[model samples]
Each structure stands twice: as C-alpha cells, then as structure tokens.
Target: MNDQYQALYQTFRWLVPTQFNIAEACCHRWASSSPDARRIAIYYEDESGNREVWTFARLAEAANQLANGLVKMGVGRGDRVGVVLGQRPETVVAHMAIYSVGGVVLPLSAQFGPEALESRLCDSETRVAIVDHASSANLLAVSDNCPALQQIIGIGFADERVLPWRSLLARQPNEFKAVQTRSADPAILLYSSDASGAPKGALLPHSVLIGNLPGFVASQDWFPKPADVFWSPADWASTGGIMGALLPTLYFGHPIVGTRGRFSVERAFELLERYQVTNTFLAPSVVKMMMKAVPEPRHRYQLALRSIMSSGESVGETVFEWCQSALGVTPNEMFGQTEMNYVVGNSNKRWPARPGSMGRPYPGHNVAVLNEDGVPAAAGETGEIAVNRQDAHGYPDPVMFLGYWRNEAATQAKFKGDWCLTGDLASVDGDGYFWHAGRADDVFKSAGHRIGPGEIESCLIGHPAVANAAVVPKPDTERGALVKAYVVLTPEFAHRDRNDILENLQEHVRERLAPYEYPKEIEFVDELPMTTNGKIQRGVLRLREEERAQAPAANTDVGAPLVAPAQQPET
Candidate 1:
C-alpha cells in the first residue's frame, strides 16, 4: 500500500511481455545483453564438501546444447521431460533445456518412492527422464510401467537403456534457437497431494515465472542483488522450491547455492559462513531445528544473512523473535499454496510486518477471505482463503495455476465463482492483514467447538523444551475427536521421561489457547512424518493413529522412532 510497493508492481506489470519463456528471459537474454558471461549463476556444493560453480554464459550454452540433443532424440514442443536428479548443476541445466525446447518440465523429486514416481511419470506422460545414480534404480523400476517414457538420460550412472549426459551434450550443437511460447502455454507440471491421497499435478505456464517476479522482488526486506547468494533446503520439485525460491532468485541473476543429500545442521552453518548468503527462503521448521541444535546461534556463527523468508508452512512468533535477535534480521513470512505461490507476505520495504499475521496482499494480487457463498467474509470472520480471477479492469491474474492436470473435475471444484478457493482457513483483520487458522481439512471439531490445529501446534512449539510439534485429532467416542499432539523434544528435555514434562506442555497450551483447543493426549516421538517440502504430514499421522486404534493390542502411550528413509530436515 506504500509508494515503493506501487512502483514495484507497476514496473513489473509493464516490463513483462505478453509472450514469455523463462529460459530465454533469464538465461539467453542475460548472456546476450549484459556482462553476465562470467557471472556465476549457481554455486553448487555436494554433501562430501566438493564444490562447483556455473556462469550465465556457461549455463546458456549447456542448456542450448541439451535442447539440441533433445530435439535430435525426437523431443518436440509440448513434449513432457522429467528431471529426477539431486541438487546439482545438471538440475538447473535440465530445467533450462526443457524450457528452451518448449517442452513441459516434470520435476520428479529424488525423495519420491518407486510407486509415487511411477504414478507421476505415467500421469504426466513424460517422454524422457534425466537421473543420477541415486534415482536411476527407482526410474528403472518404473520405466516399463510408464508406457510413454522412451529415454533415460543418466547424469553419472550408465547402462544399456540409459543415455550418458556427456555423450548427449557432445553430440549436439551448442547453439539452439529458443522456442517461442505464449504466456498461457504449459511449461511445468508439479504434483501436489490432495485429500484423495493421490498427487494432483498443477500445470503452470511460462507467464508464471514473470508473474512471480514482482512479489519476490518486493517481498524481501533487503532485496537480493545480482551478487547475493541464494539457497534453500526445500526440494526444487515442489512449487515453493521452484517458483518461490529458485526461479525468483534467478530472475535477479543472483547465484543460488545448491545442495545434495541430507540437510545437516552443521553443513548449513558452514555454508552460511562460507558463502556469506545474503538472501534465503527457508521453511520455518529448518530454522527451529537450528535453534534447537544450538541454544544461541548468534554468537556461534558469523552470518552475513540479510534476509530470511519462509514459506510452505506457518512461521511461529517464537521463530520470528529468535531470528530477529539471533540472525540480526526479522524473517519475512510468505503465505501461499502449492497451486498459487507467493500471494501475501511481509516486506519492510512495503509495510512493517505484524507478528502472527500473513501481511497484506501484494499490490497486483486480489486476495480475500471468502465465505462458502464466495462473498468476501467480514473482518475477523474465518473463511476459505481465495483469490479473485480478475481485477476490476478484467485482466486475469497471471500467477494463478492453469488447472489440475488430467483432473478436470478436480480443477472445476477448485473455483467457486470469480474466486479460486485455496482450501486454507484464514481471517482478515481490520488492518487488512490475514491471520491463517489452518487448512480446511486440518480444522477439526471437538465437543461442539471448532478447533484449528495450527493454534495449538504453535503454542506447543513456543515452549523451550519442544523442538518440533504436530497436532491431530484422536478418535473419541463421546466428543467426536479430541486433540492429540505428536512432539519431538529438545535434547535436554528428551533425557527426562518424567510425567511432568507432558503435564507442563499440556498446561502450556491450555494457558496460551482456549480450553477446548488444548491437546488432550500428547505422544512423544523422535520425528514426525514430513513431506519433501518440509511440511508435517498430518494425514500420515492420522492414518497411523487410526491403525493403532484398530489393532488387537496397542500401546496407549506410544513413543518410538518414526523417521522415514532418505528423510532429512529441510526448509
């Protein structure tokens, strides 16, 4: 609502052309117009401490060569290409090449299991896949099941059916004519899990990249410059990791720090100190993990971090307070969904952030809290978060998703009228800042009282003894469902198994929230189930609880290690 915000939005709206291609605009244009030939585009570090860097000219050439190779291999405009590699130089190059050739990108997360990978590969009808040793076996397992999949390009691994990365690059020309794409042409396919327990693909277009630029540029308190190094622990396959972090950072031509393997707290600290990362977008869970690992991190590491923005989950006030004092900057929290990224958030340049609020809606976005009838809810009334399809002049919101790929019915259900339902429960305050309650599915009722788990979970995590927390409804015969918490305690508190720990935590929530919202039963665990994007998988926890109830003999007080394989704490 400030002059600076209005100027930023107006500038971007005028600059972005009606037709766009991410690879061309972010890569080739820079390579041609400016002195970006030697500028580093990406700074990559493997888990073993090995490092590599790529420049804009080098990136452009690599992407061009790969695009030529894809064309030679029978790939054409609109073809689907899958990328299933870890965080490496090739991951970025593969994305660039796919976009250059006008092929839709299918970013298959390395964290996906065999069945999940197969489901996506088939659903997207991906013609080709690029993988490394870590994901080759999984790709091979599902290759035959994906009838449309014709080729596998290996980054490091080699086999009869696999094409070598170097060989393919060597055979192709280093000059490729960039394909022309309309603003609405599908460019990327990212799958997000829904209530049906199946992953639904959100097909995004070329305009999405340009549409995202304004919000990100305006949302950072200390806006990232070309020299700033950006990094994120979240999987690049997810919408948050791609549109929210990777592409937005790339738009500024800033160097991105790429990571592979598990997210080690020690390594994260090392990277921060070594790279002097000025701007970053991380999940709140990752920051909390750092605080739990080190009591006072401010005095421990010398960090040059200027701005820390978090999305994919609600950031608690406790995390914000710690960040302000420890990191020397109050973290900016972004509120968005997988379908539409970066809808609202705080940026000191635009407005002072209010603690516990999702900030005001970005200048160009028409967002509101809507009731069931699709009308904007009154201030303080919680309702489904929605975005208007068009503004007053009838220009469509470019950041909105095209639809759920291959699921027309699901796509139709996502829109109620002019507003696109986000399925998130929120309320707009008198100041126009939105306060997130919880997801519609995540909200539950207990004894005639509607309860949002986010409120209780935030209170539990605020306690010094608790490290990570998740709240779910436990089946109760008398009161439909009772609140239950699954928690991971800090190291100091983990050693003590006294009953008072549970009692104190229960009291902690009761004092901070309504009586009916307090957790009725608390379960301690080493870890909670999380998605690749660092969101707590409450559905999985709910399923596990239901299974335990149906068992012949179940432990009433459950406490055990629940870590998933290939799982690491990420933001």
Candidate 2:
C-alpha cells in the first residue's frame, strides 16, 4: 500500500480487513479469523423462520463457482449479471461473484412484477439472471421478452432447466483468477425512479466507489470489532444499503446480522436482544415504527447496542432523544444517494450529533451547495448539492458512480459543466450543516407561493392523531395548485369520525403553517402508497388528488367557497 492508503488505514483503524473487493475481504476473514469468524447467519421469518448460514471459505468457493457458471453461460468482462431475488443471501453472493470476475451486477427489485423486472433485464442486456423461486413464474412469463438472457438460476428449488444455488456451490473450483481490472471498470448498475417515467440506470465504477469509501469510513464510530453484529433494512439496490449493509461491515471486519425477509420493529427488537446486536442500520420510518410499537416507555430495553444509525429517511429530534435516553445509544445519521455513496455522515461519541442536521461532508469529499446557475450557494441558502472532482488530490471521492448507465443524454443533462448534479435540494446552515428539503420535482407553486411538500408532511406527522402523511399539489383555478394531504392515522384515532378528524387535522395545519401551505383537503387512508424502497409514491398521491380536484361539484356548490368538495367541507 502507498503512503495515502497507509494514512487511511491509520485514520480508520477501527474499520478492519481494509480490502477493496468483497471476495478478498471474505477470503481474509475466513483464513485468519478462524472457522467461526467466516460464518454468517441470516434469520428469515417469512419462510417458516427458515435460517441459513454461509462460511467465508465456503462463500469464496461458491463465488468462484458462480463466476465460472457465468463464464460458461458466455458472461465476460463488462457484461451485466442481473439478480431478481428478494432480500436474500443469494443476491449478495451473486453481486460479489459477478464483480469478482469482472462483470457488473444489475440488481432487480424483488418487489418488481414481471413487467418492471423484464424491462430492466432487456435494457441492461443481462446475460445471466438469478431469480428467487417465488419470482420464477413471473420470470418465465417474461422470459421470451428479454432477448439477451442466456442462462437462468433459481435460489429455491432446483430444476433440469435452471440450476439451484446449492448445486452450483457443490461444484466449485474454490478459486478464481482475480481480474486485473482498472478502477474505472463498471461494477454495479442501479435504476432511478420508475413511477415518474422510464427508469434510468446509473452505472458506477469500482474506483469511483473506492474514492467515496473514505467518506463512509471516516465517520463511523465505535471500532467495528469482529464480535460486532451489523444489520440494515435498506435494500441492496440503494447506495445506503451498499454502504451500511455491505461496505462498512465487510471492509471493517464487523459481523453483519441480516434478514432475507421484510423488516419489522418486533423483529428488530427480537434480533437485537437475541443476537446481542451491537450496531444496526435502519431508515427513520422503521425507527418511528419501533418507537410506536414498543409497549414500554422509550429506550426501556437494553440490548447491548453500542450504536444505531440511519440514512435515506430523516429522524426527528424526539426520536433521536428517545433512542439515546431509552437505549443508551444516540442514533447517527448519514447522507448520500444513488449518484454518490456516503458523502456525509455522523458517528456516535465522535462527531457531535445535531438534532436535525445531516452534518457536513465526510472528511474526504469535496462537496458544496450550489445555486440555480451552479455557483456555490451562500451559507444558510438552499441550493443543489454538487461534488467537485479533482484527480490530483489523494482525498478524492472513489465511490462516485460512473454515469447514468448507457444514457448519455440523461447523464449530460445532469452535469452543469463539471459538477455532478444531485437533484436533491438542500440548504447549508451557517455552521456548514446540511438540511434536506423535498425533492426538486416535489416542490410546487400554491397560490403563487412556492411550497415544499416535505415541510407540510412533517407538520402533519407531528400531530398526535397522525401516523404518516404524504402531501401533493392538486390543480385549482384560483390558486393554480392546491395542497392535498393523504394521511395514515394513529391506531388510536382510527375509529374517529372522518369529518371530525379532517376538521382537527385542518385546523391543526392552519394554526401550524401559512394558509397556502395547509392542505386544502385531507383524505384518511389505510396506508400511504410507497415505493419498494419505502419512499412515498407522491406521483401516485398527486394523481389521486388531481382526480378528486376534477370531480364534478353540486349545483348548490356553485356559489360556495372555491374549495372543491375534494378540499372544502360540504356546504
């Protein structure tokens, strides 16, 4: 290693193994840490509490076998290997294997129906597809559609046509010639939003990812010892997942505890207590659910937890304080996205925890807030977030993605000259701390005043009767757009009268916010429509609100207040 690398190892001495590739990391842990250190157990409840574990040596062998399997199926360097498994271990192995042998891993969401999954496979020209048995039927239905798929593997039952995961592992070479790939070679392919339109693929290189690793490593508190158990609920398709679930643990020598099934607060509590889980990763929504579901007062249970951190979702001041006082651990928050990995983060006991701020950029990243035209935004001003790339500096972002996969037009559009445009809108405080706003597209004009839905939604969620909320603008003649809120009421308030509840929520909002920002209409719903990744489907909510806005009004309503029935109370 060079002087720079040595300095990093010293700086992040707490993060162990210090390997570039997952395969190598596994091999090192297996060979030196003893047979026990290499074993990873995944606790899955949905499949009849079915549990499975894989040893490091065993996984290294399996990865080699899978790479050979891909090679036999005509996959090669720069080729795309698509995975369609649910939140399962096979997906993890497949990603490492594909990249270990110089292919790119294109992960398809298990939540995807045949249509979405097939579109991605065809778009990526995937040569090999590994699907969970649950999704096999859907895959077969769409098999004839993807012209480039040459082979298929199943994670469940074996078949004459499709190889099972176990069978592939049984016939392994136990070794692979490490591909001497440049840091610039593509390794992962990720998709953008689907409901908004056609999803775009963002391609990332190994070196780009390496550059960004320092930022992620710099902020992690509590040296991740081999005895540590790490868990994260974020999916593999997202950067937060890769950073929290895979990168920190694998690179730092920490034992990770993961579930292949869905995440639950009850399960979270159970696993933490049962396994002595020391470190955990979860979204703010999950944390909120945990706070809501637990029967005892906040932070009542002690689970030997040293730290709990989160990303992708924001944690509130109350939630942050509750965790610290209840569990004896303060929650750390990190910030980053699909384009850049962990650009900024907070670590427990080291970095000062801000109640609501996401904190400054990681020690290694060259990050800045830029105005509409790309000049740096003044402190305390909102602007687009951008990263400056300077190759000469050793402290460059190694984990930035290559570009939008094969979509030059889209990639070119995002680049305002040299800076990588993060569509997220944010404001930097005078202290250099960053505050997240709603997405740029999510901002809308209401009564000629610009509004961000996140602020309204945040206010609604603070209500005692509200559980979760999503706000969108509906078309209106007088205001051009009207705010409509779809809410999930707290369990205790579920049986309340709709009008009474609406009145309470409306009055509450009007008192808390400006008249224009208050929802013109409030709709009680069982649950907010959310993406597979757990983000609210605001577009869907917007469409529902628009339909309600277009609904015909009664003849008597003609002289009534302009608020449509969709918004205004009955005359």
Candidate 3:
C-alpha cells in the first residue's frame, strides 16, 4: 500500500525472449562469455569430506558430452530423461545435459523407494535415467515395470548391465551444439502428489526460470550482491531446490555449494561457515530443526548469511524471531505450489515483513484471494489464494507452468477463468500482506467456526517444550468436531511427564489464542508425518483422526488422557 512498493510493482516488466534454453542461459553462455571460462559454478562436498570444484567451462563441456551421448541413444526433444540424484555435481550436470538436448528433465529424489520411483517414471514415460549409487537400485527395481525406460546411466557405482556415466561421456564428443528451444517449450516435468497420493507431473516451460527471478532476487534480499555465495539443503529434485535455489543462482553466474548426504544441523552450519554462504533457501522444517538444535548459530560458527528464504510451509513467528536474534538475519517466507512457485513472498528490504504473513504478490504476478464463486475476496476475508494467468499489464506470466502432463481435465480444473487456483487459503489485510489460514483441504469446521491449523500450529511451535506441531480436526458427535493437536516435543522435554506437558500446552494456547481455538485434545507423538520436501502431512494426520473416530471402541472424552508414544508414518 506504500508508494515505494506501488512504484516497484508498477515498473516491473517481463523480458522473455523468443529463443531461450535453460542450459544455454545457465551454463554454456556463462562459459563462453568469459575468455578463461574458469568461473566456479559448483563447489561439491560429500559426507566423507571429499571435495570437488567445477567451473562453468567444465560444466558446459560435461553437459555437451552427455548431450551427445543422449542424442546418439535416440533421445531427442520432448523425450523424458530422469535425473535421480541428490545435491551432487552430477545432479546439476544432468539437468544441463537434459536441457541442452531439449529433453524434458525429470528430477527425482534419491530418497524415493521403489514404489514411488515406479509411479513417477512410469507416469512420465521416462526414456533414460541418470542416477547416483544411492538411487540406482530403486530405479532399476522399477525399470521393468516402466517399459518406456530404455537406459540407465549409473554414477559412482559399477554394474555390467548399466552404462557408466564416465564411460558414456568419454566416448562422446566434448563439444556439441545445444538444441535451439523456444521459451515456451517444455523443459522440466516435476511430479507432485495429488489428492489420492498419486504423482502428477507439472510440465514447466523453459521460461519458468525467467519467471522465478524477481521473487528469488527479492526474497534473497536483491540477490547476486558482490561475491554472494549461495547454498541450500533442499533436494534438487523439487522446485524449491532447483527453481528457487539452484537455477536462479546459476542464472546469475554465481557459485553454489552442494553437499551429498543427509542434512544435519552441524553440517549445515559448518558449510555456511566454511563457504561464507551469503544466501540460502531453507524449508520451514529445516529452520525449526536448526532453531531447536542450535538456538544461537552465530555464537558457535562464523557466518556471513545476508538472506535466508524459507518456503514449503509457513515460517511461523517463533522461527522468524529466532532467525533475527540468533542468525542475525530476517528470513523471507515464500508461498507457492509445485505448479506455480515463488508467486508470493516477503522482502524485508523493500517493505516491512509481517511475521507469519506470506507477503504480497511478487512483481509481474497478479495475485488475489478468490471466493468459491471466483470473485476476489475483500480484505480480511479468507479465500483461496490464486494467480491470474496474465500480469497487471495483461502480459502472460512466464512463471506459470505449461500444464499438468497429459492431464488436460485436471489442468483445466486448476483454473477458475483466468485465475489459477493455488488450493491454499489466506486472507489479505488492508495493507495487502497475505495471512495464511491453511490449505483448503486442511481447514475444518468445529461447531460453527472454521478452524485453520496454521494459526494453532504456529502458537504451539512458539512453546519452548514443543519442537513441532500439527493441528487437525478430531471427529466429535456433540460439537461436530474439535481442535486436536499432535505435538513433537523437544529432546529435553520429550521424557517429561506427558500429562503435565499436555495440560501446559492446552493452557498456553487458551491464554494466547481464542478459547474456541485452543486444542481440546492433545497427543504426544515421536514425530508427525512429513513429505519428502519437509511439509507436515496434515492430510495424513486428518485421515488418521477420521479412522479413529470410526473405530468400534472410539474414545469420546474431551479431556482424554495423553496417548502413549506413537510414531506416524512418513507420507
């Protein structure tokens, strides 16, 4: 609502070119721009402390070689190629190679099990997979079921039946012309879970990276500052990792640090200190874990982090304050989905960031809170957060995905007229900042009041004893439903008397939030269900509560005793 923000939004323009290839823009051009072509692109370290550095020259050459190899094997434009690797150097190389050949890149998580791998590969009809040792077995296990899968290229492991990554590159020419691709050509096929837990592919165009720039730059506090080193532990398989962190950093011709292993708080701190990382994109779960593991990171490790962008879930006020006091930086919480990402976020430098608010729409995006009838909701009214296909200037938004792969009906259903529905619910204040209510599916009605899990979860997370929490509606006969919370206690508080902890949590919410919003029942659990991308699976918890209600011997006590330790399954 301020004049400065209004001016910034009004002056932004989209400059997408007719011919654009992600590989050319992120790698080859940077390589050829400089005479030496020796600018560092990646600094890689493994769990065992093995280190390697790749310059733009090396990345481009490797991509060219791989592109040639893939082409010789009959892979062409529009063909699907899977990159099932973690945050290693080859992951970046595989994406570049896929883009260079105009093949659709399918970035799969290395942590996926056989069933998950089969679902995505078979759905995408992936022709070839470039994988590391960790993911090779699971991919191979499902390859027989995926008839379209023609070849498997393995890295860091030997198998006579599989093509070695090095051997394939060594036999191919080191220089090949990258296929000319239009800005609207399909570049990536990212699989996200649907309502039924099945994977649906969202095909992103080459211009998707261009679309992500404004929000990325703003969230990272006007990124690419002098010598700005970037790092993120988010998996390269997801949008937050690749689009939000990797591709954006690479587009600016900056070096990004990657480590191959499970993320630990200690390792994260060490890497930030060792690399002097100035910008990072962390998920809310990672931020919370860091807050719990190290209350004061700056005290133990030397850091130069200028900006931290957190998404995937709301970075609650508790975590936001911790970042300011402990990390010496205010984290910008971003909002978007796999189909359309980085649409809404906070930029503390440009405008004041309201903690727990998913800031205003990024420039070049037309966002609004839409009611069920597709009309924009008035201020302070809860509705679905949606983005228009066109910007304020009536230009096509480059950041929007092409469509869900081969699922035209589902794609059509995603939009209400020109507005693409995000399936997330929020309310805009008079000042235009979006306050998250909850996921549309996650919000529930208790008595006559609609209850959103986010506000209660945020309140629970602020409690010192609670490390993380998920709020869900518990089925009730008299009251229709009741607010129920699953709490994950901090290590120090895990073994404390459960009854006392539960009572304390109930009172904490009752004193802070509305009495009706306070959890009527609390369950202490070892951990809540989480997605591979670190989002709490409130759906899973909600389903569990529904099942419990249908049981023959269901407990109906409003003040029931705390349940014994139970571990929720991973979603």
Q: Which prediction has the highest TM-score against the true structure?
A: 3
Best by lDDT: 3
Candidate 1 Cα errors over 4 Å, as ranges: 1-15, 442-571
TM-score of 1: 0.78
Model 2, span 136-157: residue lDDT tens: 8777778879999878888876
For every model shown, what is its TM-score relative to the native structure?
0.78, 0.73, 0.80
Per-residue CA lDDT of model 1 for 1-571, tens digit only, reads: 4635545444433244767888887778777756777778889988677888898888998999999999988888889999988678898889999999899999977866565678789989899999999878878987999999999999887799999999999988889998898888989998765543356889988888766665676566646764578877767776767876788777677788898878877888888888988888777667777877876766788888888877645566787888887788777778766577777888865677767788767756788899877799999999999987764245777788899998999999999887888888999988778998766776554543435566567678889889999888786544556889999999999989647899999987765444566788989999988878888877777777777767839775468777555554553
Candidate 3 per-residue lDDT over residues 1-571, each given as its tens digit: 3435677789999999999999998999889977637889999999899999999999999999999999998999999999988899888889999999999999987766665678788889999998888877777777889999999999999887689999999999999898999999999999765433355789999999999999999999899997999999877887888988899999999999999877788999999999999999987767887889999888899999999998765677888999999998999988877788899988898877789899989998999999878899999999999999999999999999999999998899999999999878999999999998766766665543435677678778989999989888887753557899988899999888989999999988875544567899888777777766677877777777888889848764433333324444553
Local distance difference test, candidate 3: 0.85
For residue 29, model 3's alpha carbon misses the true position, in angstroms, by 0.7
lDDT for 203 in candidate 2 is: 90
Q: What order do you get sorting by TM-score, best first?
A: 3, 1, 2
Winner by TM-score between candidate 2 and candidate 1: 1
**Cand. 2 TM to true fold:** 0.73
* Range of the 10 consecutive residues with the lowest summed lDDT in candidate 2: 556-565
Tell me the lDDT of model 1 at 90.
91
Root-mean-square deviation of candidate 2: 11.5
Residue 399, candidate 2: C-alpha displacement in angstroms: 1.9
lDDT, residue 305, model 3: 94
Off by over 4 Å in 2: 1-22, 26-46, 158-161, 194-196, 295-302, 391-395, 443-571
